[model samples]
Target: MFEKILPFTRKKHVAGLKCAFTGHRPQNLPFRFDETDERCLRLKAELRKLIVQMIEQKNVTHFISGMALGIDTYAAEIVLDLKSQFPFITLECAIPCETQAAKWSERYRNRYFGIVEQCDKETILQRHYSSDCMQKRNRYMVEHADLILAVWDGKPSGTGMTVTYARSLRKSVWTLDPNTFSVTVE
Candidate 1:
């Protein structure tokens, strides 16, 4: 149902090295929307470390986030925070639909908008949501990116599916398990 994609940022030459994010939502995370929890804080720390590693070592200049809750939100924020240090890096919000956060709580909605406003690029994949819109957005990110960064619990969920899809395309996939704080590359 995606007829057109819209970008809200001024045009710039796309970067050569890019990374895309796929992850579970808040409900599936151990902290369950409680960012103050020690577990959540630790997870964010690890996530930030991984992103920095990607930027510093791999020369990844572009990061794409699905703009979902939980890990996606964390990734976008981490990218923004690192911008002062790595001014060449850019964050792209690969939103699945125009109203992706319409049903979210007011707190989350505000957070989403704040991140979107600060992002270097905002890509709305579709004007309206569809049954497969999320998957469509995931594929869009994987297709555009050179590497896929995933936060998955090894379950048959959306994040798992995105990892599988990335592998099938022979894209480099790095997975970080939020539960054990372990990372695997494939």
Candidate 2:
């Protein structure tokens, strides 16, 4: 009955409840990578608040995480923890490449793959690493999300680039400071 609706002309499925996450790796964070670190614990608490806001205030039901080491992994874990309360919320993993975590430590690699296994969906941008794969993954998240949750230090980083790209797309970005555990809309 709708054969005339061309692919490009057809209305896209715009998810009203979509959010993406971006953040710096462990080395870039101001604190040690241990979850028990005071800094890490504080950020985890704050992230729980933000995700709750997204669910209760913004009606965000779908979350996308890049699954990187430091902040991204923590954010994904928080979302997974919240799933028991917000049963409808879904997590999606956007990986840059198949071998993205090849060089990571065994523990981190296992964590990354575990999260990937639990995600509702995964989009692998490339089979192998390319200079632009990360950027491409960032762009995909920006294009798909209604909002971006970034853990940035207000410096030059891939996280910063993702935030800039989200802003350019007219997507609202909530930036979190790893140093002070503060969130600002930029």
Candidate 3:
């Protein structure tokens, strides 16, 4: 099962210019992950730069977000902010299940809805959660995207799993460190 790893250069080679995002939650952040935290702000800034590069430099027009908290939410917001400049850009929310955020605090839930409301498309995986639902969502994004922007800390988790799968599928993966804010392409 461990074969067929290919290096991807850019999204332009794919059928459509599409990309996806994955990352750790706020709790996994090295510094305070609060909205106003300096580290968090810096992370957002780095994400903004990368998103812009995807749009202007890489010719990516569509972005898929899992809609999870932390990097996922931040990435989605950055794409939305970029719409004013790249008006043709589109955001697709690929939710794992209807109750995917049911356990989140009200604050996070509100933020999630706000992002979803503005998304160009929404694909809910299932009506209820399953043991494999999140994995399925990750696969869905990887299967649809030509590239994946991953905010990871070189650790083993869902984000890492997605990155590994992306590489196996020969999709371009850009990994960003939550602590250092550096992006390395694989």
Superposed by TM-score, candidate 1 places the C-alpha of residue 156 at a distance from the truth, in angstroms, of 0.9
Candidate 3 shows a clash count of 0
lDDT tens digits, residues 16-88, model 1?
5899999999899888989999989998998999999998888999999999998999999999999878777
Clashing residue pairs found in predicted model 2: none
Clashes of each: 0, 0, 0
Question: Candidate 3 residues 1-186, lDDT tens each?
Answer: 011222323323233489999999888997645788898889999999988888878889889999998889999999989887877777889998889889999998999999988887888877789999999999999998999999999889999999999999999999889888878987
**Displacement of the residue 95 alpha carbon in candidate 2, Å:** 0.9
- Give the winner by TM-score: 1
The reply for model 3, stretches above 4 Å from the true place, is: 1-16
lDDT of each: 0.89, 0.82, 0.87
TM-score of each: 0.92, 0.89, 0.90
**Which runs in model 1 stand beyond 4 Å of their true positions?**
1-14
Off by over 4 Å in 2: 1-15
> Per-residue lDDT for 1-186 in model 2, tens only?
001111222233334579999998888877767777888888888888998998899889889887778877988888888877876777888888889999998999999988877776777877889999888888888898999999888999899888888988899999888898878986
